[model samples]
Target chain A: MNSHHRWLLDQLPQWERDGLLTPEAVRTLRERHAVDDSQPGVAQIVMGALGALLIGTGLIAVIGFNWDDFSRPVRLLFAFLPLLVAQLFSFRTLQRGDASPAWVRETAALLQALTGGACIALVSQIYNLGGEWPDFLFWWMLLSLPLVWVLRSSSVAIFYLVCIAIWSVDRIERGAPWHGSPMIYPLLLLGLLPFWPGWPPKRKLSVSVRWAMTLSAIVGLCSAAIFASERGSNFFGYNEHSFFWLWTLTGAALALFPLNQAAIMEPTRRKPQVVLGCLWLLGYGIAMTFRDTTRYIMEGSSFAMHLPWCWGLLALLVVFAVVALIQKRWAVLAISSLALLPLAASPLVKAEGGYYNSTLSWFATLQLAGIGITLIVLEFAGKKGAPRLGAALLSGLLIARMADSHFSLLAKGIAFIAVGVAFLAFNILMSRLRRSKQLPAS
Target chain B: MKSLPILVFALAALAQWAAPLSQIWTHEQVLAKGTLVRLKCRAPDPYDPLRGRFLAVWPEQTDAPVPDGAKIDRGSQVFFTLTPGADGLSTITSISTTPPGTGIWLRARAGYVYDKKVNIEWPFERFYINEKLAPEADKWFAQNIRGDQGIVAEVRVLNGRAVLADLSLDGKSFREILKERVK
Candidate 1:
């Protein structure tokens, strides 16, 4: 039997002896969920993934040695060798995997994808082929899609996400515009929808699958954000406000998405998506409190509604809010509302005292207040680790503002002392409230 | 039904191999039998990670007369028919979308328009070289001189396809220069 089932079987006898389960019940349960030794275990899946990665990397390195003395045909053979082996493995997996273990199929699919990339890269090496990195990655991604679709392997899907990350980064480096079929990324992502967490509800995702999904989702969103902002900044004469709004709105949506009822419930409390999203939100919030950040939006056009990304950002925010509302995710709805504040305030930033001098300070203050309130609410809702993080964020913002603000040394010192006192008083008050609640009726 | 996955895998594999192989074949064919034209070009250093390293180049400032009121649209494919100048360097005699009837011609796209001069980018602008040799090459060419003339490349043109056949500075191959410098 696979190790998971073996462990469960071991536990049942102990449970029966303890009277937690009757002997008959244990027998029935064991019979219902029969353990099959032939099925792939978690170790097998992990080992298979590692094995594929190693073999692929090894073959590429062998090719990289570049035996230039070899004849052209020999070199060509070397180029195709990895691909041939990978294809053979894939064929075997396809033939046997229906009766074989999940690991076998997953490993074979992963190897096929990796070997395809190896073929592309090694052929380029062997032929001394010169092209754009993104083009190479695009070829790899395109080639791997069939394996992902045919086998429905999560590993290949992760690999595809990695390829997209590299490709998008390269595209951005080349200063490509967003309008050049930017929708292709999301469309490509749609092909792997069946492998996502919620589909086939009874199927549980392995930890690696979860991590891969979380990471790829973040990378995909960030890439789009980067592309959109870069397009605005370079082509449309939009200032840093465009980037900030786009980034924060995307961040807020990702962070609050887990709270949505529509979100797939994970077996674990600390979902990777939620964690990543919170980090983005908090990090962006902390950044807005800094003085230099104001310069990003100050020099040029502060915020023009005419810029394409501005409208795009607003539209995305509205969509996220609408979705959150439908899901009845109060936290997400509340967080998404933060997007409107910048839209409302951007026009007001161009005031009598110049953009930075008046608007930045107020905006920073409002962001801090909003984040602080949100964290406090989340902490009360019993989100583990929120209280400490929320307090740290608030204190860090206070310290940063003090460092750059117009406050006198004496005023800053007084403010610091006051904050310290307030924290102590709040802690004392909270303890007292808890103590009183714990007390018996008087 | 069992063969479906295998068919899909084979097709995908063919596609992956076919794309680069086809590009290489076309370029190789042009390199082998295409007509050669030597043109002076100016260089800017750029590196493509997958493609190793090369110089991003532009044609030397030319006094080639534009046909009266030719619309210079950026990124639109345009052809430049080549002719030997007094200096024996290839120069654009005329620019059009249609192929020229006579001597070797270039396939280039019209870049940004400045006054009446339309900057055109030749499809074979890149001169792929060893990654290690690029920094030195970039420094050498950034001086913008080939023994009192600009750097020149012998570009091979076949039908509409162009391939960079050879890059020379002072009539010396870049490889020879690298070898000499290494010694």
Candidate 2:
């Protein structure tokens, strides 16, 4: 008899006695619930480990071997070697179905990531690429993108997004011509939308994978775009052509709202997608109007005082606040503040450069303050759930920015130590909170 | 599943083709003394510091007259042919505004032409000039009082009048420089 069937039978003695299951039925149940006796042999485990070791060793050897070679063809072959091997292994595994699917997939993913890194390194080696490291990075990302769907590997997707972020920043920093194109980073995130919908709630692996992909995508895209845009041209002084391209790309990404609905299998996931979709749409609308409204307000036009774009941005914020209130998602609420935060200080500083009274400095200060407050609040309100480390890291970022502005290396060092201390304190407090919660409640 | 191998093959082919496009050449092949290499100029990257990323090329051969001032129409196109000068450096000789085929072309001050050549400098040797310094030499040639359009070439003379070297915008041989950096 199957062990599970036997246990069930033992627990239901009364039912059995009352003829709920005859001898024949019990036999049928045992047959139906029988566990497969096949077990993975020690040899298989050793082989799997050996395969992983070989893959890693091969990667290092290839990189080390070709470090000095200037031949593009040779570099290209080395870059694709791991991927080719991985594909072969995957094909064999799929054909035989002998290996654990999970392990095979994981190993394939690792190979994909290695291949991606090698591709970037090889391209960089080939290009003698100086200023535009990001452009080559974008190509690396595009090449690796197929692995995300083909291998169903979230780790590969996240790595790809990271590369894209680096590329975007590089492009913006170097002022390469990336004006009218769809921001590739955001499009890459769309791949993760599939996980947020079905089956993930029941599967911890899928949920964690989805979360990593989504978080990386959102943070990386926003940071890259902001860094690039701010560094490339003055925030407000960008030409209309540039602004139009930015808005168009953002709008197109937002227009992918229908796909979000396709993935909605549960109410918990569905609600957030709906809200995020609306916010994205509204955000783009506001971004479109931001320039014209700013111009109008600067010109002292009374009619432009209540520009529709400003209202749209404000309305989006209110919606975000309301959703956060309803869903009890404090993280979302905190992030929503970023939208209004830029506008709050714009009035205090002039458009052109000013030493102390500049809008940028004030904005930076407020950003520090906001992050600091959010950290404290998160720490105090939900001691165990507090995002203390994140807050501390953000505070550190702000301090660094301030130090950089003034060219104060000492200040930067001090700020880093302070942030580290804050992170430690938060972590310690959270541990204590968890221990106390675990104690018997009186 | 059936098409997978084909797709892989196509990708492999494309990668092979695209890989060379990113490289910059570094060898002195075809760029020896007195080569009438065409220079192609690129506008300054908006993000770079003023004149920092701007590439100015004076074709070793040109058919148009040089402008008195550095300013040229924002979007004017002019052609020049490279000439090997006595200084061993290749200098641009501006051709008349008459188009190569038609004589009715508009006469405008010729702008700089930027060209890519494999730069090779021997180890422990300082024969190769810095790219920044190269522009200064080109500028001096542009402003020389001897002619309204052309300037003296010294490098071409020094190297012995090499033939006209071909210019490639598609990054070819760039990998060689990258390999050198890796070393």
Candidate 3:
């Protein structure tokens, strides 16, 4: 029996003795909720994922090796072979419908996505096709979307998110043209949208789903940070600084989205957002506090805001704002609202050459001060992990910046001692708070 | 409802396979039954993300007349009337968006433009080989070809479409040259 079933068995005797349940009722409940004997465990899932990956990679290597020997038609035929087999497996799964085992359905969906990508790569090799990397990724994603919908596959959705993150990075940082990536990215997220609604009420998601979401979220946020410019064009008049501000705001919104949900308030359910979003926010906060970061953006004197990506960022911000308003998450509302201040300030300062440095210094100082105070407040409010890490990170960054700016050695030593004392005090206070029931037990 | 999704998948599968096949078929038909013209061009090696490495090419038009106010856009099709020179190498005499029916002309995309001169990109700019041979091809092209005298390409044109049939350097085809070099 699984751990959940075991725990239920342990509770049954106590429940009957305490008059919470009768013997007959306990027996009926136990029979109804019994664990399936044939359900695959963690080892099986890991092995299945590895097997699919190996087969996909091996298939590509073998075809690429013998690419010259085969006739044109033969090469073309081979490209479609793996895809056809994958489709046959998908057809069988669909025919079985819900009667198919969970493992069988998931494995078929995973193979389908892999083989489809392989098919694309093989065809491009045979034809000597030339296009940007994101174009190839976009086609692979479009072909896989139907499989996600037909199979109701969380695995394929995760796979799509992984590709979206990669395509975003390629398009943004490598100076590839937009190619509708900004628009298509969010639309693709809808493939995974169904999974969230169908999530079980009182249980954690399977380990594979949790890990996939975490990895995708991290990649997505990091890609946003690398949005240096829209190829050669700058849509937002203020340059990279404005996009940096947009990314920071987007990170905060992603972190807060899951937090506001009453149904998903459990720590396990909230782990992906907390780790990905809050860590990203913390890292951005640290980078913003540095003198070099300000100098990098302030050197350029261009300002105007119009691009598809800028509009896409705004659309996302509007969605976040609407949700925050509906949920009455006042703290989230205030943090998101703060992004507009720098958006308005940077362009005006940039129009004139002399004030750019002064404007950036003031902006950096305000962000550092704001983020530092917020981290401590979160720790006091009993939000663990991210708050503590954010606080440590903020303090380290402040110290590093202060030292780099040529503060006296005496002042630096005093600052370090003061930070240590503050941490000690925080630890003591947290323990007392926990004992007195002033903070909820984690 | 059950058969509906399966039907959609089948259609998507057919379309995916058909798109690339149609491209190959069009090129094959032109190669079999079209007018062949040898054009002067240059080749350089470049990497394609999925296909590994390929030789990126530029076809040189030494004596083509410059047109007035012709705005060339990348990926936009343009018609070029071809005439063979004394060396039996074809030179573009005129270029336009609409096809000229009187003489043999090949359809090509307007590539890079400078002043009155435009570099038309033939459909076959990339020549794929094994990934290991890409660096060797790049080295050989850099070493042997000089001053637009050695490089030549035979292009088959039909019904406003063209396909690259052979690329030669100093009288030998590229594949034959590579075969000798490898041996």
Candidate 4:
């Protein structure tokens, strides 16, 4: 039996003992994994990627050794030689066709990607092209593009995303006028969007695992859009509130809209966009709850806030909100409360860069708390652990505020004890109710 | 149809080889047929993540008065036409926003004007060399470069592109010094 099947079988008895699975359920699970035994699992692909990673790191180290003692011709020969070997490996995969194992595809693609980069770096050294790092990464990303598409290599696709995201940030950091991050990053992202692995949206995948994958992708994408240029032209773009609003809107868009709009047939499907969008929205919401963080939004800046700033992104958010409203996604409707979040802070600050006394952050905190409660009521229906996540969001805000609050030491200590006691009481109540439901009809 | 994957792979492989080969070719062409100019320079050792170890070579003089009525912003690419100075090393004859139609000129990035002086960021500022030899090269450079035994960067300028073909100190090529240091 395959490892996944063996592990599933091993867990069946424990699941039965815990009443998490009936005999019928255990039998079905066994039969399901039995059929899936032929398929290569994540283990194989991870091992292949790990092998590629070691070899790639070693390749770069060897190239970084700078074999400059050799004549230019000899060094040039060395440059293409490894690349040729990597290409031959890829050719072996192509000969086997698409039915070739995942490991073969991942190793070949990743190996070729690294070798191509090493070759470029080697040639740059040979010619003494002491130019920018961003340019080198850009070229390397470009050269690896074919590998991702031709091999349908998911590992390389992710690798490409990370490199390009980094390239975008690095390119933006260069501070050239008419810099490309605002326009070009999205274009490059469009190039990789077609290759985004669709497994996360599949029905069979566990929810938490799918959420993890979605969040990983969102992290990759957000790293690229660092908003360095937001300090320039347009309204709040120059204001300190820019990144706050920008990320809030980004999260709302991802949370409300189908991330992969093309594959979004089931309106209720929990995709990366929605999973991470809520997280992004809430993540920033938590940051805004900090009195010091929110105080800087309208404080210290002498310039008066203007109307209709960040219009493009604002328009996109509005369209997504409308789409959600039409679809009756009430959980997303809770996000409308965030529109008032920054305003809640507007009156809380003392003038001129003071970092304290945003008393009204509670209003903003309340908005997020409302959203968290709504998520518990709506999205977590019969779902395990997610309700705790929603509760944690609200409870987390309460703790953060208490840490900054002016409550008496005695009061704070008593509140902590009360929360701990309440948690224990709540868990006992829940377990009792669950046990009652499982009791026989006496 | 059966050979399609191979055909595509061949194209990608050819492009990968072509990118580096083309870079090497263009640099070689500049060295071969371009006008040879020596520039007074000094080197400080630094390493690049990808390009490995090299000396960060700064030419002794890289500024000129902005041409009348020329506004150069920081990060703008400015081209400078070269003329041999009193030390027999290339110095800036004039700065222009556009490439020179003829004669030996090289492009460098501009820094903000300080007292009407335009600071140029030279493209060939990195002279990549063997990693182990860089420390000794920096040492030799520090000891010998400031005085009459200045480090002279041998450069070749073709059109507006320039390449640092070699470096020498007091009539001896840098390679010879590195060789002797190794021995």
Candidate 5:
């Protein structure tokens, strides 16, 4: 047995003596047998570095070729060159099973990285690319995704995430004018879902990767929302309310449901981490609604008076505070301070519209009052009720805005009444569902 | 493992070597006009409207005909047939045909006319074709007697239809013209 197995065995004897190694535990241990051996050879290291250098050089040369002058066929062939070379190299490595595992892994990693680099270069070369940025990004992401599986490289996965994030931003910027294509950004997160609490490593690296992915999602959503709001005329904008809610709901399902199910099956101690990540993600969704609201108020010239109802912004700050308190996460607290700026700035900036226009003044007051009422209601809802209530309230606000924009005042009032009734009915149904789930079955 | 890196390095070296082979078309060569020649429409610097960029074609062997009475449409299509003039430059002779819309306007002289309103006849003798079509004449002179083996041009006409016709290269192909540069 290798040193790692030996070490594991050494620890097991004491555990067994202590009666810790039950039959089930022993079976699990046997299944996870480690065979860590000597460090990689000097030759292997040299070969890996040489291979990487060659691949890099080849990529540079191919991309540097006057692609602009080449015929379409020639340009396409050049684009696939690196992928072909990398795949062939990978196949050759796999065929030579006699090679050291470390060597195989290193070679695979190099090939994977080169493939990713080549893809980026090839995409940069596609000529006369029109306004379909999202579709373009989605295609690139999908093309690069297989490298993650083929090479088993997290780096490729990270690259894929970055592309998706960029795509999301592009989608948001195009607004309603942007028609949907086959590319779905949510599917990508699903692709990465299996790698969560990724191959055990130092805590710092794992946390950072998790944080990085989360931050990317947040930035992507925020950018998309901003784009949707501004892409059309200053008055009419894309309805991002449904988009945000659906995205957040999907995100929650992916992060929470899968992790919970996996934890039950694996009996792993990482369950809490998964839960924490989901909660933080939920908080982020709440936070985004407010951040977007604040940005709209500041940047949107027409809606300057509606600044007071910017309570979504304050609600977001509170959500962050609650998250920090619950998780005792210092990072959350540090970031929460940044939210204070909007609160301080919004009130200080005097209302810019004419005072004689009661429409502007009344709208501002209604916003502040509405936000104040929502916050009070949320405070009564307490910790357990906050997430669902926040979601419902935000959805209602979006629906109201859409109605007001698209319908007559009479129609708007009727729609508001219908929505209010629907909300109450949903709340009652949810309570019953909760009650039934909480009760023990006979 | 060691071989992997070495293989990569070898591939890189091979790529560097292969890159230069494709750049063989960059050099210029001279050919005589009316020497059957070929021209690849390679716009060297793509037109950048924002930057006010444009390409100017200067033909050294053949000059465009300037019509005397009719003003040439600034962007109208005109054809050329190679005929050595007194100036020793191959000039385009005008052949009558329905303007731009009907059949092969084969006998049309290659020249520039001002607006149709001016009615000026400035026929072949002003503009010149690229001098590169010169050495191409020797090849045509030796092998292409029937005119079947000469350069044919598909010129984009005013109505966007491509009109295919034999460009009167005295007797050469673009390859033959380029070959002179090596000699």
Candidate 6:
């Protein structure tokens, strides 16, 4: 049996003796879990995927040989044949409905998406139509996106999201991505959202899908800032087009989304959106304290992109904020109006600088220190997890200090590295400790 | 009701196939009737996962003599006409805002421009070849360039679309080079 099943099986007898479970329940559990030893493990699944990848790679390598002796029509035939077969497979799988295993459906959908792309690419190769790669990608994605909906395939949905991210960021390094395409990118992303979190009784998006969508949203958000430093400064003037605008807009959007409640559900009380957003906001807040970054950071809701896509979500910060004014839930009203805070701060903030020894830096240090102490006090008053969160905020705050302080660049680098090492090491240790019953249950 | 989705999936699959099919139809039309032109080029081999192995080729002519009546930037589409130069290989002679009324021409995205000269990026930058011969082709092209024989691309152009018909080194295909190496 897998270690997880063995461990669970071991727990059942103890729990029964303690009256946490009945003897009959324990017997049922043992029977269900004992058979798990014969089931495929994660390692086997990973190996299967790797094996498939290798075989696919080999096939592609052979196909890359050009089949020079074959006539043009015959080469095109090779391109279309696999795709046609994959379509027939999809039809069969669809006809089976839910009777077939999920992997079968997922595989059928993924194979269709991939083979369709390969077919397009092979056609390009055979025809010797050498153009921009994005043109090929655009058409491939255009053709494949529908399969995500028609097949109800999360795998294709994720694949489609990735394609959007790639397509949106093309030529962004030059700060001039192809116009119109990137602008409508968020709308394209939104097209998939209404279908997610499932339908009927389930009513929830899968965690991986949610995380994928979140990551893609972040890429879109970051493009605003980086793109602003180049294109926005020229057209919109700098401050009006910065990350400050992005955050305020995003924060307000998230706040408006669940409208008064957290993006989370009952019982756990875990605010994933708020906590993560807070971490990012803290980092942004610290960067703003730097002298060379631009004094205008505090001037307004700075995270706004040139396009004012502030209508977008910030990782989810108001989840942490206690402030509620005006209409009771509006972290907005006058809240969203923060879009105007950017006037001419762009004039002062150049591309680089720090707040070391600056008044703003000292003030932020005092504010975070005070909040950390207050949270510790709350923890002492019997709140669980408060002290941990408070301590993390303080340590992160200290790291921010080390970043902006008068330390040499190497010293700062070493300090950051050690902190990262500690961060990962502690998590690993905590997980083991919790499993061994040495650490307090979270 | 369930059959409706299967029908939709069938339609989606047909739509997917249509894109590559159209590409084939267009290119086949060009190959059948388009003007064939040879251009001297320096090529380096690279692998595109989708398109497989191909040469990223830099051709002899990169700029139009003088750009007339058009604002050109790195991404703007610019049409340029090709002509035979002293070496009897095609060289880009001129750029026009609109497609030229007469001679052999192809469309290219404008690259960096300087000194009133419009630089161009060739649409036919990649010349697909057999995978085993790709790295060999890269090395052989460099050698042949120094040895005074050149790698030339045979391109077919019709109505602003250019297809890389073939690549030959000193009038021989890379297949011949592979045969020599296997021996």
Best by TM-score: 4
Query: Stretches of candidate 4 above 4 Å error?
Result: A1-40, A172-174, A180-183, A196-241, A257-280, A286-294, A299-309, A323-340, A343-362, A379-386, A401-405, A427-442, B1-10, B113-116
TM-score of 1: 0.73
TM-score of chain B of each: 0.84, 0.27, 0.83, 0.86, 0.25, 0.87
Scanning candidate 3 chain A in windows of ten residues, the lowest lDDT window is A298-307
Sorting all predicted structures by lDDT, with the top scorer first, yields 4, 1, 3, 6, 5, 2
Against the true structure, what is every candidate's RMSD? 6.2, 14.2, 5.7, 5.3, 17.8, 7.3
Clashing pairs in 4: none
Q: How well is each residue in B1-183 modelled by candidate 1, as lDDT tens digits?
A: 367766776786677667656765776688788888778887676765444455665668544455786775666678888887777678777887677777777776676667777776666556655555666776677565655776887777888677766667777776578656755
Best by DockQ: 4
- Tell me the lDDT of model 2 at B54: 20
Using lDDT as the measure, name the better of candidate 5 and candidate 6.
6
TM (chain A) per model? 0.75, 0.44, 0.72, 0.73, 0.43, 0.65
Model 4 TM-score relative to the real fold? 0.81
TM-score against truth, every candidate: 0.73, 0.42, 0.75, 0.81, 0.37, 0.73
- Angstrom error of the Cα, residue B140, model 6: value is 2.6
True contacts kept of 4: 0.59
Cα misplacement distance, residue A114 of candidate 4 (Å):
1.3
Q: Please give the lDDT score at residue A337 for candidate 6.
A: 25
In angstroms and one decimal each, the interface RMSD of every candidate reads 4.7, 11.2, 3.8, 2.5, 15.3, 2.5
Pick by DockQ: 1 or 4, better one: 4
Candidate 3 local lDDT, A1-442, one digit each (tens):
3557768877888999999999999999789767653344555545765777677767766655536656877887777788789878877987887687756666777787777777777766665555566778878877776766566565666777778777765655433333443434455565565443234423344545666765665556445444534443446434555556556556666655644364334453445654565566656645645655654443321221344454555677778778767765543444444444445456644534543345655665576566556656765776433344445655666676666678788998888888878767766775676677865658
Candidate 5 has a TM-score of 0.37
Docking class for candidate 6: acceptable
| TM-score of model number 6, chain B | 0.87
Contacts from the true interface found in each model, as a fraction, amount to 0.17, 0.01, 0.28, 0.59, 0.00, 0.71
| Position A5, candidate 1: lDDT | 68
